[model samples]
Target: MAFTTVPLTALGAAPWEPNTTYQTGDIVTYGTDTYQCVQGHTSLVGWEPPNVPALWSKQSSPADTQPPTAPADVIASNVTSSTVTLTWTASTDNVGVTGYDVYNGSAVAGSSATTSYTVTGLSASTAYTFTVKAKDAAGNVSAASAPVNVTTGAPVVDTEPPTAPNNLTAPTVTTSSVSLSWTASTDNIGVAGYDIYNGTTLAGSSNTTFYTVTGLTANTSYTFTVKAKDAAGNVSTASNALTVTTLPQNSTQYEIIGYFPSWAAYDSPSFTPSNIDSSKVTVINYAFLDICWNGRHGNPSQSPDNPNPNTWTCQNGDGTVNNAPNGSIVLGDSFTDGTADGGYNQLVKMRQLKNTNPNLKLFASVGGWTWSNQFSNTANDPVTRGNFATSAVNFLRQYQFDGIDIDWEYPNSIGVPCASGQTCQRTADKANYVLLLQTLRQALDTAGQQDGKHYYITIASSANSSFLADAGGTSNWLSNAAQYLDWINIMTYDYYGPWDAASGIVSPLYNDPANTNGNSQFNINSTVTNYLNKGLPANKLTIGEPFYGYGWKGCNAGPNNNGLYQSCSGEATGGSDGSTYDFAYMQNTGLLSADSTGKYTIAGQGYTRYWNSVTQTPFLYNPSTKIFITYDDEQSVHLKNEFIKTKGLRGAMFWELNADRNRTLQSIVSNDLPH
Candidate 1:
C-alpha cells in the first residue's frame, strides 16, 4: 500500500481537506462510508474518517424507515357557514405517530398534535374535500386518510322586502289615539310586522293589520302611513297617507242606554227609529247581530209575510229551512244597491237622528238569548275571534254605528238550542270570553283611531251568582271585563217570572221577607251590593229596569204580601208573547192605572194593587180572576232612580225602547236620574 501512497480521492472517497471545521453531529462521507463528527475539530492530512475511529463514527442504518399508516375513521363535523372541525383515528407508525397534517385537496390546510383539528375561514356555500396525514419524528408523512367530503352552508342573505300595504285607513280617531288598519303586505319570505308612521316618525307597530297609535295631541290633525317589514330587515315603501283630526274630550255625566230591537220595526204597534225620543236617552243599542258557524256575521233574512219581517228564520247548514225562527236580524242597511229593507232603512233613520241630538251614540249589539249559540265557538280560537272582530268593524262602519255591544248571554251556560254542528259552552269559555273582549277592545281601538272619535263597548250582564262564578271563577266578571267596557248594563229585573212555579216580585229594590221561597240575593239591591262588593266600580254599572212586566194568573190574592211568592196555577192572560206585557200595553189597555195616592192601581180591571214596604215593589192581585201582575210603574221607577243616585251608580237602562209608549216610566228616569 506504500508503493505509491495514493490519495483518498483516488479511492473514490472525498478527501478530508485542511482548514475545514466540523461541528458535533455533522454528517459526512469518506471512503464509501458515512461518518458523523464527535467533536468540533479541524481536518488533518492523515486523519480521515476511515482512519480516525476514535474521533468519527459511521452513522447507523436509518431508524423509523416506514411512515405512519393512513389515518382511519376520518370525520368532519360541526360544520358551519365558515368553519368545520375534523377528527380521525390515530395512525400507526413504525415508531410512533407524533402529529397529524390536515389537508384540503392535497394542500396542507392545518396541523394538529392530537387527532382532531378545527379548520376555519372556509368559504360559505362551497363544497370541499379534506384528508388527514400522520407524521413521525423522522418527518416521513403517511398517505392521506380516506378522502372526506364536505360542503359549507349557504350564506344568510336577505334581499327582498315586503310589498307596500294598501288601503291604509283609520277606523276611529280619538283625542290621543288613532286606530289604523290596512291590507297586509306580501313578501318572498313572510311579512313579519308593520310600522305605523305619523308624519314620517314611527308611532307604533303591529303584527296584524290593525294598530292603535296613541299619545297624540288632542284636537290636532295627524297624517299617518304604514310600512311593511320582513325578518331580514328589509322594509317596503310607505302606504298611502291618511289624515285625521281628533275629537275634543267628552264631558258627559249620565248615561241613558236604550235597546232598539230590529224586529220592533216590523212588529205590531211598529216602533221604528222615527219613534225614538233622542232626548230621553243618550245611547241606543241595536239588537242584535249573530255569528254564523262559518264565522260570518248573520241576521234574519227578511220575509215579506213573516209578520215581523226582521225576525230571523233558522236555516240548516245545507241551506234548508227549519221551523225554528231565525232569531237574528240583519240591519236593512247591511245591503247595498237599494235592496235594504225596513230594518236597514230604520237603522239609517236612527243614524240620522243623531243630528238632532249630537251627544247620542248608537251601537250594534251582537249575540242575544236566541242567537248566542255560536259565541263560544267564535271566541274559542284566534282565527274565529279575528274574523268576528273584523266583521264587527265592518258592520259598525256600514251602519254608522258608534260602537259595539257584546251580548253573549250567560257564557258557560245554556241559551237557546245551538245550531247544527255548533258548540254552546266550554270550560274555557270564561277565559276565552275575556280574550274575546280584549280582541274586540284592541280592534275597536284601532278602528277608533281612524274615525277621529271615541268608540264604546258595553255588556248586558246577568244578575245572578251563576253568571259571575261561571264567567270568572269567584272573580267578578265586571272586575275582569270592566276596563274594556264603557259600562255594564246589569239586568236587575227578571229575578222571578213564569219560569218559577211560585210568583215573586219581578224587580224588587230590596229583599222581601214575606213567605219567600226564592233567592234572597235575586233583588236589585242585593244584586247591586253583590256586584259592588265583588270589585265593580259603581260608576261603570248601569241598573237595568224592565219596560215589561211578568204576569201570573190563578194566584192567592190578599192585601198582606199580595200575590208575591204565592202559588200560581199558570201564566197570566192577555200577553202577546205570553206571560209578559209591555208597559205600553198595560197602560193603553187600562190593565194598570195610577191611583190618587200616586200608587199604581189595578183599578176597575178586577185586580187590586198592593205595596210591599219591605221589598219596595208593587204587585197587582185579583181575587176573583186569580190574576197577578208584577211590574215597575212610574212611582217604582222614581224610587229606583233615587236609589241609583244614592248608591252613586252611573244611570239606568230599559230592556227596550218601544215598551214605554207614553214614556211614563221614562219621564221618571229622565227627570229623576242625573242628566
Candidate 2:
C-alpha cells in the first residue's frame, strides 16, 4: 500500500522502553510503522515492538475509536443491612478497559478497576437496583449492564434484650468493700457488659461478669443486683438479689501488700515499678535486699558454684573492716554516669510514683527464697545483728524507703545453697530471729526519731506449724516478734508443688478431704488458725497468696478426684518447678479459662476442670496428655479475701505482683480487703 509520510506525533505513537510494561490501547513506534500493544505484558529484549505479533499488532491509526462491550450477568451477594456486594461479568474493549462505574438507580455510587464492587452505607430494609458501566482508557464507555435488585436485611432491631445474669453471689465482703460475681447473660447477639446496682442505685459497671463495689459504709447491709447489656443499648432484667453485711471496722484498716521481684526486669514482660498499680496495693515490697556477713548490705557478688550467679551469699566475712554504713542498694542493672536503665532502675520510678499515691508505701524486703541462706548467720549473734540492723537503717534511708520487710524464708529450716561451712538452719535461729527483730526495731526507731517519721518493720514468716518449735525450743517467738514488728506476712502458699509425687492445689483456702498425703494442715485456714492460736495477733497477720501456679505432667487420670491428688510421672511443661507459669502467662497464652459453671479449664490444652467444694479450689486434668495443673483464679482469690475479712486479719499479700494477669488477682485483693 502507498501511504504519505506521517509524523510520530500525528500517529499518536510514543517511544517504547524495554523495561516498561504496555497494556492494550498503548501505541508505540518502531522504524516507520505504528504498533499497538495487543496484550498486557512486559517488554523483553527479544520481543521488540516489531518482533512479536501476538503481543503487538500494526495499527492503522493510534487513536482508539471503539468502546468496551456491555457487561453481562450482573448479580449481588453477601448483602447486609448497610452494605451489598455486586459482581458482574467483565466487559471487553478493542483496546483496554480501564475502570468500571457502579450506579445506584441513575446516580454513580462508586467506581472500581475490577468487575466486583461493594456498595456501602445503604439504608437498611430498603430495596435498591444497581448497574455497572465499563470505560476504556480512551474515554469511551459501554452501555449499562443488566440491573441487579437487592433488598438489604432489616435493620437489626435488637429488640430482644440479653437474658438476666443469674447466681448473683458475694464472694468477699469487707468493712468498706464487697466483691460480687454472677453467671454471664445470654443474648441473640453477643452481650457487651454488665451493670451492678446497690439497691436501686447503679453501683458500677464491668465488661466482665464480676464487679467490686467500694466506698461502702462499714457494718451496713447492702443488697446488690446485676443486669446485662447489649451493644444496641438494650438492657436486660435484674439478676437475683444478694444481700451481704460488711464486717465491723477494725481498729487498724487491713493492708494489701505485693512484692516486686528485682529479677522481673529480665523477664519477657519486663515488669517494672512503673507497671505497679498503686491503687491496688497499700505497700510495694522491693524483694530480696541481701545482708552480707562482712557487715555490708547489698546484692551478693557473682559466684561460680551457684546456678543463679547473682544470688546472695554469706561467705568471706572481714570483721576487721565494717562495710555496714557504706552498703549500696544494687538494682538489676547499673548506670554508668547519668543514663536510664529501663525497668531495672525501678527505685527511681517508684520514688516518682510516691507523689501520685500518698497512701502507698514502699518497703525494702530483705531475704527471700534463694537469699535466705545468710539469714541465720546475720541474725544468730548480737554483734552481727547489731551490724545488720545499723546497715538496714542506712540502706532504707539512702533508698528513700518508708519501711522494711524481713522475708526470712524460715528460722530453722534449710533453704537453697546451704553451703557446708555456712551456719544455716541453726537450732537457736528462732530465739535469734526474735533478737534480730528487736535490734532492728530499736535501730529503726532511733533512725525514725532522727528523720521525724515512724519507719515500719514487717516479716514474712513460714506457714508451717513446726516452724516456731523448730526455731525455738519452747520459746514464744511469734508473741515476742509481734512486739517489734508492724505485721507478719504469713507465706500461706507453696503448701504443695511438683516436688511431690502427686499434683495438688498450690494454695487452697480450706482443707481438702481428697488430700490423703497428710497435707490437710497445710491450708490457709489451718495455718492462720495455728498462728492465731500461738499468740499471734489477728490484726498483725497478713495472709500471703500466690500469683502463680504449679503443674505436673504424665499424671494418672483418675475419676475419684478428677486427676487431683493422683500420682504424676513428672512435672508439666509450663509449671514444672513450682512457679513456672505466671498468671499473666497462662491467661495471655489462652492456656486457662474460667466458665460460668464455677469450673476452670485449660483451654485447648487437652484438659478438663474440676471444682472441689471441700477445698474451694479448681484443678485441671487431661487423660490423653496426662497433664495436671492446679492454679488459683478470680473465684479462689475472692474466697481467700473473704477468709481474711472473716478472721479479722490485717489483710493479704501476694508473693510477686508481676505474676498477675492484667492486675486481675490484685483487683480482687484490693476490692475485697479493707482499705
Candidate 3:
C-alpha cells in the first residue's frame, strides 16, 4: 500500500476525547484575557497565574464575542390541569440562532426556540414556576428569564372510570402478588398521570403505564379503576373499572427446610430456590442422619474428634468394648470407617429427609459389611454387648434418630470380617447373635425410660445362604432376636453373582435352571419365604431393593449361546466396589435413560441392557455381538414394590440413599411404599 500526503484542512481537528470537550466557560484574565478553548487540550502561552490544569487558555479570536445569551421566558396559560403550557422567545446569537432552555423551579423542564411548549406530567390543580434561557452554538448560556409562576385549573374529575380492564383475573396462582399491569389510556394533554383505585379507594398513582397491586386477599374478587390526567389538570373520565379475583389462599403451601452434606453450595446464602411453593408435595423427606462414623461433624470449631465421644471412664470391661463417653456426637463420617468425628454422608441425608417430612422418622444404621468386627464380640458376651448397646443409646440421643438399624453381614460365617472372633468363634454364631439383640433391647429400653420415648430397633440381614445356614435351614437365632426388634430388612439383591461358578444372572427371579446343583435359590419369592419360614412376621419385614446392579464375566456367542450373557461375559468388567454410579452424575452429564416399557438402561460395552420388571433386576444382551447387560430401573422397582405390598411387608430400604438422590428410584418407591 502506497502512502499519500493529505492536506490538514481535509481532516477536522483530531477527534475530541468524548466528554473531555469542554463547553464554553468564563474568560480567564491572566496578564491579558485568554479565551477558553472548546477542547480541553492546552494552548501553551507564558504562564501568568499558574492555575489548575483544567483552565486551558487560547488567544481570543475576533469571532468570539460572548456567544448569544440564553433567552428568558415564562410558563403561560390559565389551564389549571395536569399539563402546563410554556412559552419563550428565541435567543439572539452572533452567529445565528439555536435553542432555548425552559426551567421548572430551577430544573430543566422544557426546551426549544419556538414560543410555546406543552409540558405534560404536571400534577392536576398544582402550581408551578418556569423560566427560559437561550444558548448559541458557541456555548454561551443566557441569563435565566424572570420566573413566571402558573397555577393549573381544577382537574376534571373522571368519576366515570375509563372502561374497566376486561376479563381481569387473579387465577389461583402461587406467586408473591397479583400484578395489575393495565392497558394504555388516552387524554387531551396525553395521559399525564394514572390513578389506581382498588375497590373504589385510591390505592396510588403512577405516571407510567403499569402497576402491581400487592398484599391482596387470596381467592377474593376486587374491582380496579385506572384514571388518566392531562396537562391542563383535566382528569380523563374514569376508564371502565375491571374486576378480577386473587388466587385462592395457598392452601397447601409448604417449604423444604433441611440440610445435608451433599447439598450443593449449601454453605452460601444464594443456594435457595427462587420460587418456592409448599403445597405440591403432601410429604417430604429431608434426607439424612449421621449415626456412626462422624468425620465431618459440627462446625469448624467444635467437633467430635476434638472432644471425643468415647472418653467415659466407667469401663464396661471385656477390653474389646468401645464406649461413647462424651455423649455428644455429630453428623457425617468419613467415607469408609466409623470414627469419633461425625456421622457419614448417609446420616446427613436421613436427617435432611426427616426435616422435610415432619411425619417421617429416621434410624441410624450400625455395622455395615465394612464394620462387622464389633458384632461377634458384642454378641457373645453380655458385658461387651452392654457397652455396645449403651453406645447405641448414646448415639441415638446425640443424633436424634428414631431408632437404630443393625446391619450385620451375617450371624455366622458369611463375610470375611466375622471369621476370627474369640467370643463365638464356632460355626454356632447364631445363638450369640440372638444374645446381642436381647442386650440392645434391654439397654434401649432403659435409655428410653430416661428420655421419655421408646426407641425402635431394626436389623438389616442378608437374604443369602449365610444368614440361613446350610441346607437353607432357618437359624434358631431369629426366634431369639425377633421379640426385641421392630422389623428386619432383608437384602434381596446380590443373591446371584460371578462368585458362582458360571457367569449368570446375579439377581434373578429364579436361580438359573441349568445349574447342575439344583440350586433353586436367589429369587424374590424365595427370599420372602426364607424370612417367613424363619419365623419372621410379614408385617415386621421390609424388603431391600438395589438401586444399582452387579456385573459378571466370561461368555461367548455362537449358533447356540451359553446361558451366560456374552456382553457381561467379557472379562469381568467389575461391578461397583461399594460405590456405584449415582443419579446425580446421570442428570449432570445427561446420561440417564428409561426404556419404552419403563426400564432403565445405561450404555456399557457396545450393548443395550435393560432391567427385568418381574424380577426387580437388570440384564443386558447384545444378540448381534451376543452380549448381555441388566440393571435395575422403574420396571424392576415396580415389581419389588408389588412384592412388599402383596406380601404385607413393612416397607423397603435401598442400600444407600445417594444412589438415586435425584429421585429416579425414589419416585418409583414412593408410589409403592405405604403413605
Candidate 4:
C-alpha cells in the first residue's frame, strides 16, 4: 500500500500543514495515513509510505523568498518623539512563517508575530525608516519591506499668552467709581478671561475685558492693572498700571424750582429776607404770586381768577421796586411769564440776586400745584408748548434768570388735587411731557444765542411711586434732563407724612415690614434705581431730603415707633395740623439728637423716637397724646450720604433754605458733596 504523496516544493514559505492522523503511535497503514513536513524543517509526521520520497532533496535557494515581496506597502503614521508606530501588509510565505521582524534604518528594531510594529526611544526632530520582513523557525530572513520614513516635530513651547487687547478706554470716572472696557484678547490655546486689579490688590476679575471698580473714595488717587489668561491657566504678566485721580464732585451751583410772589420785590424786608449767606447758598425756589397763566394780572390777591397787572410788581428798580430789594430774588416765578409781556419786576429781581451773589443762579420755574393743570394742555400742543418755551426763555432773559425749573405737579397725572379734567389727565401726558421738554430745550437754545446764557431746565416732580408709575417718569428723567438741565432732584423726604390717610413709617431707607411692598413706595434706592434702570447717569441725580417732619394722630407708640409723638385712633390730622418747620426750626427747638445706637429721633408734640437700625429710618409716637411724626435727621442723612457715595450719585438737596438756614443741613451737604 502507498501513503499520500509528499510535495517538498509546496512547503517553501507558506504555512506548514500538519498531519491530522496518528497522534503518538497510531496505526500507520499504507494509504490510510499521510505524512507532512513543517516549514523550514525536513521532518515528516505520521507514517511515510514506501513510494514517498524520504529526506526530500533540500532546496537551498534562500529559504525566505525576498520576504514575500518585501512585505508590500509599509506605512508609518501618528509619529511621536517617544514612539513611532508602523503598519504593513502581511508578508506571504510558501510554507508557514511564524513571525515578522521590523527594521529601523536597516537594523532590527523589533519582532512581532503580527503585521504591525511600534518603534520607540527615537530622538525627537529626527528622521526614521521602518521595514518588516518574514521569519521562519529555520532562522530564515525574508526580503525587507518597502521602507517608510517619518520625521518627528520639535517639542512645543507654550510660553506666551494672548496678544494684549486694544481700544482700552475709560467709560466712566467718578470720585469712587471708574468703569473701563477694551477689545478682547485672542490666543492660540483659547483665552480664559481677564483680571482687574487696583494697584497690587486684586480688585476684581471678569470673563470680559470690561470692568468696574467700586467702593472707592472720592477725589482720591488709584492705580489699575489688567492681565489676560489662557485656557491652560497661563496668565500674562500684568499690563502697565494706570494712575488716575478721581474728580472732585461739585454742587456749587443751584437751580431753584417754586413760586415767587410778584410782591417779592416790595416785601424784601420779610419774604425777600436775606438770611442765607450769599456765598454758601447755591439755589433758591420762590413760589409764584402772579407770573403764570394770568401773567401780570394773575395775582390771586388782585383778580384771583383774571390777569391783574395793576398790582403785579417785580424786583426791577422803577418806582415799585429797588435794585437791592429785587436782587434778593433767586428762582423765578412758577408761571410761564410770557416773553412778550409779564414779570419785568421778577426779571429785575433776578438781576439783583445775580449781582448780590455773583455765583448765585436763578431759574424761571413754571407750573405749581394749581397751575400744573395747564401743563398737560400746553405740553401736548406744539404751538402751546413752543409758546411756553418762548415764554420760559423770555422770562429768563427779562428776569436775567440762569435757568428754568418746571413744577408741573405731573403731566396726565394727579397730585394734591385728584380732580380729573382735560388738563388734569391725558394718556399722552408722558410722551407729551417729554415733547414739552424737547420744545423748551430748543427754545432755550435759540434764546441762548441772544441772552448769552444756557437756560438750565429742571422739573419738580412728586415723590410717590404712584406718580412715578403713572407718568412713566423715573429718576432717569434726571439724566434725560441732563441733556437740557444740570441735575435731577428726587424728593426723597416726602416718603412719609399723613397724606396717605394711614400712619406709617416715614423716610424709610428700606421697606417697612408692616407695609410689605410699602418699601417700594418711597425709598432712595428705589427712586435712584428706577432712574438708573432707565439709563440715567448717577451724576445727574440729586437726592431730596426734607428738612421738616410730618405730625400725625395715630395708635401704637413703642420701640418700633419711638416714644415721641402721640398715637391716637381718630380721623387723620389735617395736613396743616402739624406746624411746618425747616431744619433750622428743629435745631432751634433742640430736637436734634442721636440715640446711643446712632439713630435720629425728634420729640415733636411730646413724643420721642429714633431711627430703626433694621429699617434705616426715623419714627415718633406718643403714648399719652397718641400722636406720631416721622422725619429725617443727621443719622439718617449720614446713611444717605454713604449711599450716595456708594452709588456714585450726585449731591443732595434740602426742601428749602429756611428749613436749614442755621447751616445744619447745609453743613451736611458741604461735607458729603463729592469734593
Candidate 5:
C-alpha cells in the first residue's frame, strides 16, 4: 500500500553502521558512493568507504565527469632537508573539489583532501618541482597548477676540513671501553664529528671530542688517533696517537633533560625540529599535551589570549574529534601540531633521525601548570584512566615520542587553584595519581614489548617539599608512584616571584635565610633531600632549573640587600607574564648588561646586579625604577649542576630550551653533566 507514495531507492544500499562487519562484495551507500566491500571488515569513522579503498570499492563512476578548475597560486613553505610543505588556492568545480593531488615531476607525490599538502621523503640539498591538481568526487582530475620549485637545505660542498683535534688524552680506561678526551676541533661549517681510530682502523665516532671506545680486550694496550670531520665528510689529519692500558669496566651518563615546549616553535626566529642539536641533550621533553573534556582547554594565564589562535582543537591530529574514550589525551594545539609543517611533524622529523641522535630520547610532557585541570578528572576513574593510558600510547606511537612526562599541577591538592575560587583539585587525586601512573606504566610496557622499544615515564614535581607531601594527604602517594617512573623532574625554581609581596630568589640552590614568608622551606637542596628521605632514589631525580627569571618592582636598594627579600610595593608586570622573563629578554631589554669590568649588571637601566651568598642566585635592583629581578646566570646554572652531582641526583632539567641565550646555558649543562 505504501509503494504508491514511496520514493525510488538511491543505489538500493543501506548505510554502514559502526562496528558492523561486512563480507566481501557486500554493498553500502555513503556520501556520493555505492561502495561494495572488497575486504571483509568492521566500519569506523576514519575507515569510511571513501577513505579506505582496500576495504570498499566505489560501485559506479561519477555521473559528473566535468573536472575542477586547476588550483592556483601554488606556494611552498617550511621546506627542510627532506620535506617540502605546499599550499595552493582552491580550484572550482561544477560539482565540487573533493580533493587535490600533488605531483613531483610526473609521479604522484602525495594527495590531500584540502589545498595544502606536505611532500615528504625528499632528498637533502636537492631541488624538487611540484604541481597540484584538483579532483572532483567523480574522480575527474583538473589541469596541473603552475609548478613551484623548492630546494632543501644543508651545508653545501665543503672542500675545507675541520681543524685537527689536539691534546688527546685517556680520561677513563676500562676493561672493555676507553673514555678519551681532547681539545675540540674547529670547522668551516661546524664540526660534525670526530673519528677515533685504533691504529689504522676506524674504531668508533663521536659528535663531541669526548667518546668512550668499547669492545677492546681487557688489560690490553691500545693506540688511538682522533680526526676532525665536517658534515660534508671532509676529515682532518689524524692527531698524535695516544696509548692507554685498559682497567676494570665502568660507565655513566647523567641525563641532560631539556624542556622543549611546543610553544617555542611559535616564537619569531623559531626553533624547529631541525634546529634541535641532538648532541646537546640526552632527553627532550616536548611539553603540554592536554586532556580533553567539555570540549575546552585551559589557558596559560594570558589574555586576548587564545582568540584567533592555531591548533586550539581537542581533536586528533587529523582535525577529527578524538571520538575515542572519555578523558583521553589530545594534541594541545593541532595548529602548532599541524598535519604537515608544525611542531608535531617537526618532532617526527627529529625522530626519523634517530641514528644521528641515537641517545636522544624525546618524551611527550603532558599537563603543565595551566592545562592540568582535566588531569584530575582523567585520573580519578578507571574508565577514564584506561582511556587516558591507551590514548597516551597511541599518541606516543603516532608522534614517535620515546616517553611520557606527567606534569599534573598539585596532583591531589595544594596548587594553582582555578579562578574565582574554583577547584580543579580533588581529594581523590591522591590515590588515583598512583593508579594513573600504574596504568600508564603497564600500557607503555605492553607497547614497548610489541615494538621492542623501551618507553620511559616521568613526573614533573614541585621542588617544594611541603607541596609534595601535602599533595598526598598523609599518604605519601608520590613515593608510591615512583616505582613506575623513569625519573622525577623536580621543578626546583619558581620558589618566589613578583607574585610574592617581598622580593626573593627565583630558584635558590639552598634555602634563602631571608625567605621568612610562607614558602620559606623552598630550596633545591631541601627538595632533593625530601625525596631521598621519603625513600625515593636520588638517581631517579632530575633537578629542574630555569632558563628564565622573575622580576619584582617598586623595590628598595642599599641595605635592602639589593632588593633581596625587600618589600616590593608592586611587581614587574612588563614581561610575558607579570613575573617571568627569559634570559634573552633581560639582555634584549637592556635590563641586564656588562660593566667596564665585564661584570653583568643592569646599570644601564639604573639597576645594579647583586649575588646572594645564601641563595647562590643573582638579583638586579634598580634604584630609580625600584625594579628587582632575580635570575640565573652561567655561574648560577653551573652551581646548580654542581648541586646535581653533589646530591648524586639523576641530572639537570631546564624549564625551556627556548630561554637559553646563545646556547650558553646548554653548553654549561653538557660540560657539567657526566659524559
Candidate 6:
C-alpha cells in the first residue's frame, strides 16, 4: 500500500508521541502552537490534532483572518406552526467550513453540520426572519446569507375530545394484574392515547387500547374505566366501567432470582441479606467470591503472575486468614460476611427457609466484573481448573449454600481492566471456558451425590453474541457449555452506557426504532430470541434486567426526539456520578414518578419521562439540564415477566436488590412468576 506520512519529529512535535496515552487537558505542540486534548485516548499516528477534532482541539494559534463565503439561496421548508426547517447553498471556505449557524432575527436558533437546520420551539401565529452563517474549525465566521421570512401557521385548537373507549373487557387476569382492552375511540384530530382509571384514581395510560393494570391483590375485584385523549390536552368522558377479579397464585416452577452483592452494605442505606424478602425469590445469587492467585485474592492490577501487591485479605467468616492456592475461591469481603452473628449467618438462615419453602435456595456467585481478571488464567490449565472446581464445592458446603454461580465476566476478554488499557487472556478461552464449566459441574455433582442434594451451576453470560459465535455459524461455545449448566443468565443490561457513542436504553425489551447508530440488536427481545434460535432451550435462558440506568449528561438535543438516541457531550453528572442512576435513586430524586402499580409516567423532577413503544421501556430527559437517563421501571419489569412466560423462558434476574424502592421491582417478579 502506498502511503504519505509526516513524522512527528520532522513536524517539531516533541511531546506528541505516536503511542502515548494522554488524559484530558494534556497539551502537545505539533509545529507551532500547542493543542490541548479534549478527551482521553491512546494517540495513534492518524488520530493527531488535525485529524480528530473531537479528541484534540487547538488551544491557541496564530490567528487566521480568512473567513468562509456566506451561505447562498436560503429557503425554508416543512414550516409548521412551531418549527421551521431551513436549507441553503453550501458556503466556500479556504480552511473548510466545519458547520453552519442558523440565526432567527438577532438570536442564534441552532447549528448544523450541513447547510440545513431545524429551528424549533417557535410560538404559533408568528412571523420570523432567519439567516445562515458559515464557520470554520479555526473559529472563523462568515457573512450571513440573504434573509428569508416565514409566517407560522395558526395554533391548533381542538376543543372536542375523542369518544369514550367502548367494549371494555379483561382478556386475562392474574393475581397481581388485569389485562384490559377496548375498542378505539374516535376524535376530530385523532385518538392519541387511552388512560385507564381504577375507580376515579388514574391507574395508567397506553398508546394502544390495551392496558395492563398491575399491583392488584389476589381474588380481589377492581373496577376500571378508560378515557381517550389527544395532543391538544382534550380528554373524553369515561368509558363504561368493567369489573374483574384476579386469580389466586398457582404452583409452578420458575426461577425468580435476584443478585445480593456483599458490597451493597457500604451504600448510603446499607442493604444486607437480612433485608431480602425470602418469599419473593427462588434463589439469591450472592455476589461475589474471588479467586485466589498464589495464595492471595487478585486485585485490579493483575497480569500473568504479575499481580498487584495491594491485594484484598481473603479470610473466612470465622477470622481465619486463607492462604489459598491459585484458582481457590476466597471471600471478597470477610467482614461483610462474618460469623453466625453477621450477614453470613443471614445467608444460612435464608437457606433454612427452604425447609418451609422448597423453592428457596442460596448460591455463591464467583468472579464478577472487578474480580474476573484471574478467570482466564485459572481456566487456561487443568491444575487450576480442577483447583477451582474443588474449592467451589467446599465454598458452597462450608457456607451451607445450595449451589455455585460462576460469573466470569468474560472468557476471551479482559473486561473491566481493558477499559484502562489492559490486555485480555486468550482466544482459546472459547473452548477452555466450556472445559472449566465441565470441570465444576462434575465436582458439584460428586458433592451433590455425597450430600444428597442437587447443586445448580449457572453462569452470568454476556449479551455480546459475537464472543461465542463464529461468523455465519452456530455458537460452539454455548452448545458445548449448556449441557453441564442449569441455566445461562444473559446480562442484557449495560448494552449501552456512558461508554457508548449514543445514549440508548440500558436494557430495551424490543428493537428500538429511534436507535439509528446500529445497536438495534442490543436489546432484551433480540437477545432472548437469538439464544432460543441458536438451539439453547428457552428454559435454560434467564433474561437479565437492570435496576440502574445509563445516562448522558449534556445531550445536543435536549428533549427534541425525547433526548434519546442523540449525540451527547459526555456522561451524565446527575445525582449518580455522571454515569448511572439506580431505580430507587431515581424515585428518591423524583426523576421518576408513577402510580404504585401503573405503567404510566406521572412526572419527573425537571425531567420529562418518555416511552419507547417498540422497546417497551421508559427514559428520562431533563430539558433544563440536558441529561438523558435510560432505565427499566416496574412497568417494564411487569412486561418482561409476561414476555418470560410467553417465551417459555426460565425466568428473570435483576442486577441487585439495593437499586429498588419499597420492593417495587421485586414485588412485580414475585407476583408474576411462580417461585
The local lDDT score (0 to 100) that residue 472 gets in candidate 4 is 46
Tens-digit per-residue lDDT, 428-526, candidate 4: 677667666766765665566466555576666656655555344433343333444456667776665555555655566766555542445566677
TM per candidate:
0.60, 0.58, 0.48, 0.51, 0.60, 0.60
The residue-by-residue lDDT of candidate 5 on 461-548, one tens digit each, is 8876655664535466676676567778889888887777888788988876666764656888887888888867676789988989
RMSD of each: 39.4, 35.6, 36.1, 41.7, 25.0, 26.2
Q: Which parts of model 6 are misplaced by more than 4 Å? A: 1-251, 302-310, 339-358, 418-424, 470-475, 558-561, 576-578, 596-600
Please identify model 4 stretches exceeding 4 Å from their true place: 1-273, 289-357, 416-422, 465-482, 514-519, 558-581, 589-605
Candidate 3, residues 1-675, lDDT tens digits: the string is 232322223343332222222322323434443433311222222212122111333332344346565555454874646667776666676654435667889787754434566776788667788787766534466787788888877766443323223323322222223334455666434555678788778876655454445445657777877777654465655666677776674322221111111222121121111211212222222222222211111111112111111111112112122323212122222221122223123333434544455655556565454334335544544444665677778767755666776666666663532211112134445776766676676667657657877577777778775575532233455744665676677776666554444445554654555444335766667888887887666756776666655444444543335334332333344332211333434433434455566545654445555543444455654445443433466767777677677776767666544444455666677655535
How many clashing pairs does model 6 include?
2
Q: Could you tell which candidate, 2 or 6, scores higher by lDDT?
A: 6
The residue-by-residue lDDT of candidate 1 on 1-675, one tens digit each, is 112232333344344554465544456787666775543455655556644432455554445568889999999999877789899999887755646789998687866656788888899989999999887644688888898899998766779999999999877665556667799899985798999899978876677787666556668999999999997789999999999998774433578888887656434455778887888888888876566442123322222211111222233222233232112223322321012221135556778788888889998887776556667766766655776677677667777888888788768885554432234677777777876776887777777667766678888988986776744352555466664566789989988887777888888899877745888898899889988887676767899988888888878764464676788888885654567888888887777776787545655577777777877777777778777888888778888888888887878988888888677777778777655
Q: How would the candidate models be sorted by lDDT, starting from the highest?
A: 6, 5, 2, 1, 4, 3
Top-lDDT structure, candidate number: 6
Cα lDDT of model 1 overall? Answer: 0.70
lDDT of 4 at 127: 80
**Which of the two, 2 or 6, has more TM-score?**
6
Q: Where does model 5 exceed 4 Å of error?
A: 1-251, 294-296, 299-313, 340-344, 352-355, 418-423, 470-474, 558-561, 576-578, 594-603
**Model 6 TM-score relative to the real fold:** 0.60
Candidate 6 has which clashing residue pairs, if any?
553-572, 572-578
Q: Can you give the lDDT of residue 215 in candidate 4?
A: 53
- Evaluate residue 203 in candidate 5 and report its C-alpha lDDT on the 0 to 100 scale: 78
CA lDDT, every prediction? Answer: 0.70, 0.71, 0.49, 0.53, 0.72, 0.73
Greater-lDDT candidate between 3 and 5: 5
